[model samples]
Target chain A: MAIHPLRFFDVNCGIGPYYNPPPGHDPSVSALLRGMDELGIAESAVYHFQAQQYDYRVGNETLLRETAEHDRLHPALMVGPGHTGEAHSPDEVAALMRSGGARILKMFFGVQPFVPGPDPFLMAPLLDRVAERRPLLILDHADIHGVRFDWIVDILEGWPGVKVILVLPKLEYHERYFYALWERFDGFFLELAGDQTMGTLEAIVARFGPERVVYGSRYPYFTPLQTMLQVIYSEIDDEAKRKIAGGNVRSLMEDVIL
Target chain B: MNTDSGILRSALAGEPLDDVLVIDVHVHWGRWLTMNLPAAEDGIVRKMRRAGVSKACVNGILNPDVAEGNDQVASAAKRYPDEIIGFAALNPYQPRPMIDELRRCVEELGMRGLKVHQMVSAPAYSPFPIDPLDAAWTQVWEYLDARNMPVLWHGVVEEAVIARFSGIPFVMAHGLSSPATFRALARYPNFHIETASTQNTRWYMAEAVDVLGVDRVLWGTDAPLDDFAHRWGVILDSDLSEDEQRMALGGNAARLLAL
Candidate 1:
């Protein structure tokens, strides 16, 4: 470690069974905690795979029940635009977010079938409601989900209060899209699990400051040590490393209206 | 919760493995057309120092102009002979005979091995879409086989072709995606696999070790395309013993390159 052992809080983690997970990967809550401990991560904002794969209500309920006993595993419920009525109304989602103590909302536009696109007509109600709460909204990168980049721009433009964290862009050749977004939006932050292009972490810190970056493992699919070392060995200062490791996410969480 | 891995301990402590012989086999030089890289050879050396890489086997970024790319690698290797081990790049589709360029790079320019990316063989960045087993590549294979030179190939070459060139130490760059390929090539003693792709899972490297043994699995960062510490940390945190880690880190590459 450096002069101080930075505390790490993973913001992009999926817990529960995943379809065709890696050979030895355990997607259970216990496995997530064990991995965090192995990598010295203190806290995690976890969403259930059931939400992305099946019904969001069942998955959200399961996440709450499973992580209720563990204080370190913060529940991040998956939400959608209530198009099929599978998800409740916007008022109900806000109420559920408060009751469940879920300050983070995860939307999987690419993987989930209900929310096909991030068009304003589809996302406005839920996004508008969540915007009032200003919960941290974690989205898989637009490129990964096959959603157009402008759709994300629209989301950012419409919901300025919602802090969006884009996770898992390809490691190479993502600068043109991501750099432009960083320059345009102060609310946009990057979780550095998938964006490990050479000198990207240092360059991003140098240009955007450490607050615009956060730590994530994309665990089960990848090892946490991969991105952890990226942050630790980066040329940025020790304080920036600390903020990227955990402080940024902590501040984002503390800013939640819930 | 406690662990025995010193490599893991050092990496987690944010300290360089000064005592460990870490050799990154997959590094690139020169400017990439698609992405921004560090300015020059000095940038790579700075990264190596941070990651504690003893040496890197490097090649130039893929371009249609093969000789120009190889010259950049040759120049970088000459500048930092101790830290950089150059691998000559060849574009088989070039009009000039590839063997002559290979000879020039190895004999005249002092490159130790060959780096082949099929992407450069095509006009644009379309990967060598043609079957790699085609008759055109036979001459290249025969030359490397006769000299017992090592090759780091970025695209797919059938297992039969690998067995045919048994004298050459054929290292598959980003070969962890296919477990079947590993099982098929395990019979060939000269076949090796380098870990450097973005598609790798946590168990992929360990699985490679199980299939090909620790000596056949080499640690490669694909640096400048990927990050050094990110790739190094993958192996350091792998389910491998210290001896296995040592072999994957640098010992196997040293044995293959005769370093």
Candidate 2:
């Protein structure tokens, strides 16, 4: 499958390649490249669906290896400190980053974040490791699936260098939590597709400045067309649209590109 | 064993609740919140064992989320023989078809009654308002009264719900907006209150023994529910005696539904 050179980095797409094992959707470089072509996406950082509900390290490692096997795919190895028993110790995570298995780490907020024991600030070593290795860390933003804004601010204050990506925040969450984090953090970025109303993106751009937001549609359960429609039909300016539609993610990905 | 029979153990909260054959009356029997539905043996066994529940009325969510719960509840009851009873929920708007379906759950599947949730996911016009004794909602009351099965309706309105269900046996849910509804539902002989999901509406369940008589209340927990079922356990641990406790737990529900 030929690649779409226009898409910078795709986010929120399902790793349906693992479960549905398509005639063309096998977990190979060809399958990912094909996915990008079908969706007109440039490079997508997808999460293994199996890992979303289960283990993270092995699934993440295998995904990274599969991406390595493919010359075209740029993989974001997802991680959650709460789900995986081993990675709670940031030292173990630091080792993984040093070894290059850890790219951009994904954290789930509703289930894994806000669990009592682990302090959100304790991830300094882990985020620092990703930053030290120049890898960006993406955090889910919403009361439903990610960390609270207070935690996001804590992360930004603690690890300013690590590019913080907010993933798939719900509508209410975007309005209340996103604004607070934007006010506090200098480099916090919003991942779109979760916010699909006409002026939602433009409103955020107006408030937080354009550089702080990017576009990533949660696909499969949600479709590429639906996500694409939101960005295409949005009232945000073409420059801001282009930045979110592709450019912002591209800038963030440049830091983590292997 | 004498001590056990007379004094039931309870988690801290309310007075020692009723202690008849403690039935959940409301339980989710099928697996699968999204996409796929598992058999839910774990859910059934774990919930029953956790609260020391002897019987449960089950529901499913396959058909608009709660459709299959009826069958799952009944089958679970069959497996344990009187340990679980299924109560099928009927969408009131679809009242015509419900005649046959209600017959199946009660006559064929042996479900105890109908458990309809107005707040959770029931569609609009399902119940065709059994209006407050006016000539308008006569058809709705006729259809419900015809079935003669106890309708476990999850209702929430002040004097309105009680007025609408004047002659029917309705289980006011969540204490129906606290003590006010709890006090009102008591006026009707057929209406009862199930303290299942009411976590802490003090006006609703604190001194429920004094508010709603022991016989007017039932101990039902939304099973496989998080520890919220502890609300009933709190009732069990309440200061009430074993006999007074039995009526609230199962005796009252069993008699009301004729189980």
Candidate 3:
């Protein structure tokens, strides 16, 4: 590690063993922290793998327990529309946020069993509650074909107060939807791990200012190295690299009232 | 803005590449795409240079003249022998001519492998989808298998077809097109996976290394179509041991190509 001009604040990462057998890394707290230390990741917003794979409560508890000692590890609780009591009511959601000291809420519509759409009853009220706290809402765009950018537009328009981070938006949709969202909404920020195409990161930083593009690792599932290098070795200036790597995320964290 | 020309490249160059060769296993060539992105060979070469890609395996996608596509790749390979490793595109719809073209490209023109754009082909000609397992495609599969050539195909093909032609090292261009694909092809020793467009994560590469071992994973860009830096970043930034990193970045591709 040559001393670089930037420290990374990974916005999307995970802990615990994944339910999917033999296909994903099961990074323990120590393992995750060690990687962060090695990669120079200053802080990370992490969720438990069980939160997405099994029960949300179990995942949240594990996240709270695992990351409790590490000040750099901020918990991003996996949340869904309160359908099967996986997540109950808006008040209960607020309680979970407050009790756990979680400032980020992550949703997995495509991977987990949940629906995010025009319907108000299924999700709107909970999102409205999340907005009041001003916590960052991270959504997984794991499958580009399945993710509807239009639905994201609805969230941006309807829940104006809630800050949104779209995690892992694939290369296929980056030009069309990622750029569209970046250009249109002030509320949304894109996690940078997914834009592995050449020149995409430098181009985004040049066009939209480094503030809109925050460093994300999609960690445990992915490593911090690729995106970290993408910023460190990018054609963009060091000031922009500094901001994209960690400053922007730190500033965003400062803004959150919680 | 430190505009010291090639500062990043210089920094990376200082890192040890003593035993490693970073060969990108996937890239698309020519301006065949209708939506119009810069798909030129020079653009790809420049991008490869910027990303420090020692070599790239490219598939030449030609329209109505499918045979010319193979020639285009062969020509590119000739022009940039060290940088470009060419793979002929086989249009499954034109099954009969594909075998002959494959022979010409590999045997005569020095192409190292074959590329099948099954996902692109499946949708483009949706009215009649070309199945990889159909008996008509057996001769092509057997030819590649006999020669022990690698096939880089996008999306999943039937595991049985993969099993039958198990002698041919099939580099599933998308991390075996999910875990089930990995489970299916796990039995076949010759099968491998290219770490391109499979999300840029060290953990993902680690997972691939875990399931298939370091030797089976190849780093790829799917470039001109994808970001070369971003694709390479996936391998460069992973948490795998230095040796595993070396293997995924190029050692595996080197063995595949017998370079």
Candidate 4:
């Protein structure tokens, strides 16, 4: 019944206005910070909805400008595979992110049409650039994205240095694929946004240790309290809970070469 | 109440409520067809204890095997009588009369309610999409309607059919995502919704309360399939008042089930 001592540093969150936001949903940076304070989240790595709904370049710029005053809000720029020239070259985008004081690169391969499949020849150049820079890459996967486990394996194999944290993955059915990936890739991490099934969190922490699991709340779209409770009420030890809550993500951001 | 409320504080502190009654209405036992889960009785009860859920209305996942599945629910309820409440699963597509199975489950197996999933398509049970409003389910509906029993329905049921069976308290298992459906069903007193969904937003509970009022909304976790703590935390952190929260958590369900 005692209050948990763990601090939370959310690795996946979005800020700015949504195209068709939920009723009573406030997507502003101030609202996000208020929600974080209420949920006891110490810090957050955030991306702009503009990056997702409109141009990534404009969205990335808007993110930096909006979150410039808030030191607790770390910028996470949305980057594509650079096939349409909208993102320019991978190196340019990487450099832009680094110069903006952003260490997290968010990719919507599932939702973005310009972002191609995980074919080696098509994605290798971007993967290679990502591997070289070593910024924390957050890949948002949903059923509509049509992302397969084999395709993810191919991507991880191609770019081993990139610290990839999979967000919003349907873990109920595809946990076997996730376990296989965790067993194979050391750079693999999981953002606990869509992990709602019972005992899966404990199993992941038990097998891979708590260092590879990071806490995340897909804010503005979803509540952070659910995932926060998932970590706090887990059967794992407080030390492991501490790592998963905030320590793991903080360490990941600190280790980014860019 | 604000974010500094006692319930929110207790939840943020990782402590389950001892003052309020917490009952999870959507739960299952046995293995799922597609994936591995902690669906066994021991694991589920342990999770309930950890989440401070006093009772869970449990049904079986073996939909194809109707008798065996009801038996599993019965066995679990018998073993943990205080902690488990049995809900019978009847495959209307089965050759036997569903009303007979309903009687057997309630009279012999001591089940309090009926659980049906018309959406799932298993080869041995429901090979094709059968309309839940079909004549095959009439007998079962009539039986429950006459007895004033409750039904926990997983798939979509039409508002007309729900109105036809007005005596039966129908609890929509995962709640309605569409506001149109909520508005349409707001007039039906027998129609209730629960807060157990994987595809929910932070505003879902508040929006449901706005449309259906707090009394018509119940709390459920869909446990072992979904985490209890996650769903519980969502409601605790919701914008509902403490009285509204209590009604949604257990007051509504306890009234429906006569607990």
Candidate 5:
């Protein structure tokens, strides 16, 4: 069997010390790259687990330094509202992106102890800065139920310039909230990590176009091969497949102007 | 291994599978979440076929109507003896009744093991806190312990309780969601882990294999609730050795169920 060339961009992945990973799972850059090599993922945008779980400084720094060696690895700096100084203001965050050359921003406001904004009023200054830079801000939907997506929607509504990508979306909620959001806002994107419902990939592509979807393995936590195979073997056309596999994420990366 | 990509494509397309014997340890019949199925057994068979599953152990979680559900599972297993494996979905509230029912299920109805979802089945059956260590479950536990039957447990029962009933093989259904399950596996030889649900990520499956060895980590789908391809793919594509993959997929369950 002749294997095809690589053309995949994973938009949602993590590195550094994950708080709770599978037993004997190594969350190192080399391990991640090795897996990516096997799965044929040409590039990936990743954040560190420590940024979401503990401190962003350690995680963001580690993500930059570790991923710097590998051209295929693109660092997605973890940031939150500097309410208690765990994260930074929008200007400070943009500065980190400028210095670190980070093309993406990963947030875990729902999972971590950071306020992602019920009061968009308080967090306006930071969000305003984020809006101007227009980095692909990836947020984790902690669970199927009671994720402050409504709060997130308000934030998006307030600042349309901030391109938001949701990771780990549930099937039920995809129809309820996310599909409509993706439909209305061109800035909205969905990572394929949590899109596990059968026939959903085809359905999403058919309705929303493949451009709205990004290939995300959610590696170290998820098997990259599964989603990689999913996109490769989907019933969708080759052009649509190409867009989902790498084109969409590549475009997102190119659009990130620091 | 060179034909891995072609083999996966065949498996996904519902074509005749390769030599790999894929057995799904956790599957459910009847309704779950907000959706109701017209024919639960038929739906599962279709899913199993499409996902290239050789055999599947099913739990009909028709709670509050436990008897009806168990009967459905038992009959389904009988109807498709080679393909379907039955597990008695025991209701702890009906302890006395369940003991006789379980005996009947195993001896006459062909149920090989027990399936109990403490979170889903408990609160409706009994009142608050609904402890697994309650005296109400004593007779049933003793009965299972005597039989040396394996149970697919879906709740956070204490390691001490699992240690106490060392005779019965307890397989924790969802490896990721349960931290106590990992602890139990470490402490007790009888305790094992099943790879199921979205919580059973590739890393977790690899971890389960690392902690308990491939022989103790069983591949489960929690099917109908979860897709078989998505769940099983994690095991198929995991970094486990081919021998380890074989054991996790079916070998472990085959030995546990005497299938």
Candidate 6:
């Protein structure tokens, strides 16, 4: 096949699959990088399992070390409030970000002992702390096991700089949220991941200018071929299409590169 | 254009078109609604501008508007006529009102179609044959069949229900609960399915279209904050052909909506 220049560059892809148990070794940094190469993705803002589901310190540390080791991958450090069941001490959460390992501190509030929005649980306060630093907070906002979109938007609004990486937008509400983002916040981005709807991405690009969206393949979860094909053919202007495929994320990496 | 045949609209089969509009056939605004309530028109219009959605087919809602939500959808459709296609959110329980609104959708508001949910309309509306053979739905489909419009349905167990409604066109809402249903709809002309808001993986649905025809299935992204590229990416990423990709992107909906 003739080479397509856009396919050669993707800046920020999550490190997992479209399926729950994503494909990869337990925090295998190599598997993540290889997946990137195969998909023609030049780089990514990586999040580790330890960062997502398992214990925080070990997971965050593993992520830090792995990210430090990879050239093509960046990191989105996961955080937990101390009072929550999966609480990561503020100091620990700070260390991961302060150490300059993550650009956007990823938050999975649904798993918290404290209810998602408010309660004695530490989610609200912890988020306030992160907001202080003005870091983007990438949320796992799908109907998955139980992630709520309303709570996600509330948190995003609460913390002004918190740029939400609404992963799996195709699985979310295109009509509603597309309108909300442009009206509500100008900075946050709607990201596409897994092998979701890259075709819809093109459609969105045609309607909305291709600025607030990015290309995010939930890596390891989907093979490179699967993720790559999604962006291969688009209906938007070819230049804008490439941006949604990779450029938007490439620029976002200026921040995600943390 | 389908240069090989030159029978249908060049743009219809899988060719270039005049507009770059988008239509999301499957999506929902219900459940755990804790976020800031977006100003339906301004919010969606702004986002559409940002996400690149030219128009979206929004359907299904709850509580306050069980019977009236379709009106709100119609409002959005009217306000953003180019950007939104409001699907009537019918309550099988409130079948009379649901049908009333469905008629209004076609006659007054000019909506393209209807959307249903067993989980939402269930036992409350009337549940037995799941297929709209019930006095209410039979009439509803009968009316729809005469018009030849499509219905986007979500079932407690959607496939069997979809099978019962074979002659009428259907768009499966979720992939998880609707898998077996998709396999069945793969064959019929009056049915189409999308993987945007379904509870299953986009990869699986992409693979399913093959056993099913690529033309029979379409692509949609539940947007606002959801990724359009990601959903389309799955279809394009699949083994499906470019012609197939064109169909999924907007071709299928274009044809289905045309009728």
Window of ten residues with lowest summed lDDT in model 4 chain A? A110-119
Q: Residue by residue across A1-258, what tens digits does model 3's lDDT show?
A: 444546778998888887543344446888788777665678888998888778778888888998889999999888777756876467777887788788888887665334443233466878877776777888885565676677778888888877888777654444667777877888888787764555566667667887887889876655566677667656677788889888887877767665
Instruction: Specify the CAPRI tier of model 3.
Output: incorrect
lDDT of 1 by residue, B52-152 (tens): 88999999756558898889888888888889998988776677777788889899999888888858544465544655566657777787888888899
Ranking by lDDT: 1, 4, 3, 5, 6, 2
Alpha-carbon runs more than 4 Å astray in model 2: A1-8, A16-32, A82-85, A88-102, A112-118, A141-146, A256-258, B1-259
Quantify all predictions' global Cα lDDT against the true fold: 0.80, 0.55, 0.72, 0.78, 0.71, 0.56
The candidate maximizing DockQ is: 4
DockQ of 4: 0.57
Model 4, span A183-258: residue lDDT tens: 8888888888864679888878788899888898877666788888888888899999999999988887887777
Compared with the true structure, what per-residue lDDT tens digits does model 4 show for residues B95-213? 77778888999999999888777534444445686566777678788888888888988763567769999999998877745556667788998998877773444567777888888
Model 6, docking class: incorrect
For all candidates, what are the clash counts? 1, 22, 10, 0, 0, 52
User: Please, what are the lDDT tens digits per residue for candidate 6 over residues B171-218?
Assistant: 766542366656665666666777664322435644566566766676
Rate residue A106 of model 3 by lDDT: 82
Interface RMSD of 2: 24.6
Real contacts recovered, all predictions: 0.55, 0.00, 0.36, 0.64, 0.17, 0.14
Prediction 3 global C-alpha lDDT: 0.72
Model 2 scores a TM of: 0.46
Candidate scoring better on TM-score of 3 and 6: 3
Model 5, span A1-258: residue lDDT tens? 233343888887888786676667787888888767655678888888888787878778777888887889889988766767767666778888988888788767655334453346666767777677777888775654656667668878888877878777665445547676875688877777753654566667778888887888777666766676656555578888889889987887787787
Look at candidate 3 and give me any clashing residue pairs.
A196-B230, A197-B227, A198-B227, A198-B228, A222-B201, A222-B202, A223-B201, A223-B202, A225-B237, A226-B237
